[model samples]
Target: MTLNRRNFLGAGAAVAASLSAPMVLGAGKPRVVVIGGGAGGATAARYIAKGSKGAIDVTLVEPSRTYYTCFFSNLYIGGFRELSSIAHSYGKLASDYGINVVHDWAIGIDRDAKTVSLAGGAKLPYDRLVLSPGIDFVDGAVPGWDVSSQNKMPHAYKAGSQTELLKAQVEAMPEGGTFAMVAPPNPFRCPPGPYERVSMIAHVLKEKNPTAKIIVADPKPKFSKMGLFQEGWANHYDGMIDWIGQDFGGDVVEVNADEMTVSIDGEVTKVDACNVIPAMKAGKICEMASITEGNWAPVIGHTMQSRIDENIHVLGDACAQGDMPKSGFSANSQAKVAAMAIRGALTGSKVFPAKFSNTCWSLIDTDDGVKVGATYEATDEKIAKVDGFISQTGESGDLRKQTFEESVGWYAGITSDMFG
Candidate 1:
């Protein structure tokens, strides 16, 4: 199907013009169901509820009351920001935005009937559905690593209890104990995230336990912000960080959580702490809804609508957007495009193609930051990047602090756009 996305959700009278004040129509107005309330789903719900006015009945099914964005979560883990600052409620979207936010999980979707079945066993029928369920880990992809073992080895990728548990483990480890990080392969959420997290943890180790060491076992040979991370480690930790890339027999295949060791190249390295960020796939809702094939759900990019089923739209880290990394910033930007597409799909209006942009920042030390950003456009089939995307090249006093300032400003703005 042909798709388009317009960033212009017109201001002022646009709402008044879209439909009369509190317009009423059972058939003409569509029942739109949005699943998940992370970066993508929440933004989609707010915009669709605002722009549609009383024209559409919008209900968002999300499991959590508050969202902690993965975009800047590392800052919180590193002690640079408070958890309260990272956590946000859906009060804005629920109260001011005029959307019904349901506290529940979407267990199944009937594409033929165009309805969503919740875990509570209620059948909520819909004219169209928007799903941005984020991601779920594939079972048994990593040998000796299963859901049961995850409690001992926290992935901390989802950002919440697991994150807290992981952080507490790192904090409680014996002084000079080894902190091992099992990095996932590429095409995972936040490509630079694992390394940046390691950098921050190393920072923690340096001030508290100078002899503490960090061992990162990677399945990939190289990573994002390599030079900057190396430089920071050299200056700050005295090379206390040891990275074993896949080239250096560091391709981890299995783990023994009870033993606190991970196997790489037929060898096991015991450690006091382990943060194994395994591979990811579309969230459970997608699997229940049958919208996913393997790790991702396929979608038409211009509109962020599902390619398999036109009435359903998918966005964020869960959707198969080839060009963008699975970052919260990417999800937030894509939500705008998805919202417009949902509006058009409901009203039968002409859809406009979309362009997207995202910037991800990682802090290495106090007042020191690194960033990677990109520009993108949506084609009829997939999301692809435009030229000129760049990353922080080197460590300097000015550039580092400047990026920190920018990171702070970004949190302020995006949170405002999302929850403010």
Candidate 2:
């Protein structure tokens, strides 16, 4: 299915009523606690509250009061958007939907007791818990780089101050200086994100520092939309990007934040600005809950329920669900499925088969856009891809513009769906 604003919203709407389980009996309204306020959590919180019609008590625990979306932060870096444009508030979710939006870090989870411990010294009890805490870097994933070094070699993957810092560093680079990127391995959040960042940075340097160069050391030999991104780089910023893939020692890399240098295959190069996106794992809270298998939490695609614990559902970049890319659209899609299941489990609302879809849009340069996406269905085994689409290499300029326009509309629609 082609993912537009209309279909995207329609896809999430509940379908024909099916038999529901007996309504969960509890002392008060069945409590639902959602951790993390990104694409998945926010959407799940809103959907549950709205569909339950106050039958469920929903409390969302997120550390930040203002959430900055990772989806369009690249455009912000490229000057296509302002920083404020990507920042969102939970006020609407609180006021309109009546979700208890708690601005506190989720420090621990007691699955046996069905409670979430917050850093602010509060214990939130839940009948069902939604964990959508997004991704966290694996310790020692990149040699010589750690969270402590983030200030010097900003990962900027979290999309807030780090993003701003990386942009400032790029703007502060000397004329003809070199910018380097240590791209993450596969199964990371947003498969095309690193390449898009490269494009956005290239867009910035093309205007301010035309002579500036970019070097990307990628662990993978190829990436999502590789052909299209390569085409765009050649057309818009030719001779400006040097991509070193695994065959070319891109996998054998290390960084020295103190020295501001990158070492690939024993060859060291001083860099004026460096963006190091490391290997990722499920957010720490998943591990704390003891639900992770290796780096991610495994889930049943039908309900997004944890394989280890049925009462807990994992969503977004944190889950080891099959086929779907870890993206904002993917998370939002999964959230609707999870929300519907939760509603059925808690309030005896009619449930339907889980249908998921995702579209990832990348802006190559001004008015030059490309995308790839697919529709998915939950099977007994995993979430399997049904069909998919991608932008053609030689497509007309007008179609590319249309694709970009579609992405802009999606951004507006999804955010509203999430926060409101």
Candidate 3:
């Protein structure tokens, strides 16, 4: 599906090529520029590239040469999966799917010009733009955890860079040291992520240093996959995890970096390592495009199109689509819906109602895991959940295991659809 640089005839030059070769030539294909080649952006590019069959010019803009997924990042701490194992490249998306992959950062979006400005001073114009740049940090949300002091205690939410930073801190810890985790407030990416991360680190501690301990300062009393996670921690992990719920002085009021002390309810505590999962907001690109509301972008749930501007689409963690958690699986699923909607909007074809799904898997022990899932249908006012899509509280052992396997299958299917 690829064409070489020398053969990339200008947009106006396409008429001659189309006149010579009717079936295989692209004359006036609608241009689509996607920012952020993570799960949502990559999936959107692949789907649009293949579905349009040379009828759409697709260009993906991302700064990273390779993407390390947030999924299974805990495995890195547990010594199960290396950072390289989860790193994804966009070569296939460019070569196999006919997408023009630009390794650059998108600095600004010119809504009036219908173009994206790159840091290299290049401007890419598009008939339609699909933005899926994911989330970014909101400064001052957590005092003392902003740009500078984060070097001392890193929030590994974005994966890649943060993953390495957190890993180094853990590796350099003194023997039998204490590791403290400060989880974000509700409705953050991967609801059970911090808990699972601590679990994995605890797993490493149990094996390497028995005297080591893990402290959890959770903002919420209950978490995703709560029952299974607590049971596993108590039964198999020797109850090594010390959890302080929101009511029990677990809410972090402030942090002093030099002292390495976190104040919870004005009570200070010291730690050998600290992981503070800060609050999140939509990527700044969305805000630049004037599509975000508060922490996320408001999109028509049925089409994944922006409520403010119909020509632009937003998905993944950046979007505030209801009933679906900010997750990789959800992003991949929404990409297909957004792709179809964009294709239809371009070709004057039928646009079907969108259906969204997401399931997050958390591995408690080496052999045990749990999951939570949901499906939703969009309405005029908002997206509503379809019945029977969440993890059951009273399900049996075999049922939970089935759900665990389902998450693996989903990751495979979604990535295949994205880069295959």
| Best candidate according to TM-score | 2
Candidate 1 structure quality by residue, lDDT tens digits, 1-420? 111111113234464466544441332456788898888888788878887776777898988897887777777778887778888888878788778889888888998877788889888878778898888887776778777877888888988877778778888889889898888877788888998889778877888777888888888888887887877777767778999999987775678998888777787778888888887888988877777867788988888878778888888888897688888788889988988887887776557779898888888888888788888998775788896544455657897898889989988888878664
What TM-score would candidate 2 get against the native? Answer: 0.94
lDDT of 3: 0.80
Candidate 2: pairs in clash: none
lDDT of 1 at 110: 91
Question: Which lDDT value does model 1 have at 42?
Answer: 83
Off by over 4 Å in 3: 1-27, 389-406
**Each model's TM-score, in the order given?**
0.91, 0.94, 0.90
Residues 144-173, model 3: lDDT tens digits: 677677778888888888888887787777
lDDT of 1 at 156: 88
